[model samples]
Target: MGGVYVLGGDWLPDAGNRKVLTELPPQLAEARVCGLMQTRRREWDGAVVRDVLSERDARLVLTIPLSTQERRDSLYWMAEKRGRFTVRSCYRELVGEYEGDGWMGWTKRLLANAEALRNRWVECSRICPLCDEEEETSVHVFFTCRVAQRCWAKVRVEFAGDVRQSIQTAFQYMFSVMDADRLGFALIVCWSLWQCRNGAVWRGEAVTED
Candidate 1:
């Protein structure tokens, strides 16, 4: 019952008496044929046909092309470049890739800055340059700093209750709720804050609310 299915040919049995055929009717099998049949049917009937065809399992069947020449079937690994599995491809398949766009670059820089401060790779005050209230860390500098809170307040974003302990969690929350424009504004604020921190530390400049 399961060989490569040909859409327009002997796919369906010619039984006019049956209301529901086990196999897809030839009229419903081909996209062109289905479109024509839909136009001839009532609007409700067409809608029902569309709904059935749109189901995940039914749509998968539609992707199989009718064979012209008989060729031996062979299995292939889709994750690999040339349908051949390799150690590198397997690793990549398991780990995946970083697909985040927009604010990710700035976020990474902010994280690096925090790490630099932690490792004492950069000679600056251990306290947050913006707040001067707590030890400078990724979470403290970006999320919990009193001065950072003020900047967020200006944007009217609430960062209270069960405080996020990591940069990943904070970014996830922001991205889920804020659209591109809002996310851009938030990133700009963070960048400006980082710049102000740099100026304060390097040039011994005074920090201002503005």
Candidate 2:
């Protein structure tokens, strides 16, 4: 409990050391996520949180006021029972995935990267069901999964952006540079990626078509 406190991330400012969070390895990322969950559990183990997430994000996370009901949200998402994306949760963060109004659908879809399942502490393969090669992180589902790669390939989008970055940052960079029309089209492809991922994971459907 050695940090500042706030409630929710709607008004939270950006991290000062975002590179640290982005550069952390997947295993350490899980640790950072667990540290955030300490807040939800009404236990702010500030040492572990700051040690893992660096000072800036830890302070940003600590700002959120704990609730008696144990709410579920993230300060910055890991692949599983981690914090939600705090710095950038809006679809506009992905460079205007929505125009006049924001995309509530896409915001919720942020938590559905594993085709509607997210592991907590259980030791299981985090492998992508569609690819069977990489972890089923949101980045993988949308940009780097084998099926996802094919979908991007169909549209002649060969680059998968940067898999090392969080899905939000990667999407922002990938979409923001495109023209308005391409950006709109990319949003559709993004939604298709989600739908096809669900179809393949939940319905036992083949998903090679773009």
Top candidate when judged by TM-score against the true structure: 1
lDDT, residue 107, model 1: 51
lDDT of model 2 at position 36: 50
* TM-scores vs. true structure, each candidate: 0.44, 0.42
**In model 2, what is the error at residue 65, expressed in angstroms?**
46
**Residue lDDT tens for model 1, 1-210:** 123233422232221111122356566564432331224432223444445443442333343343344455444445564668453344233223435765454455544455566675766567777777788877776667888888888987665455467776776666577666666566656655765676676656688776
Pairs in clash, predicted candidate 2: 5-63, 6-63, 6-64, 6-65, 74-83, 74-84, 75-84
RMSD of 1: 22.0
lDDT of 1 at 186: 67
Candidate 2: count of backbone clashes, pairs at least 3 residues apart or interchain: 7
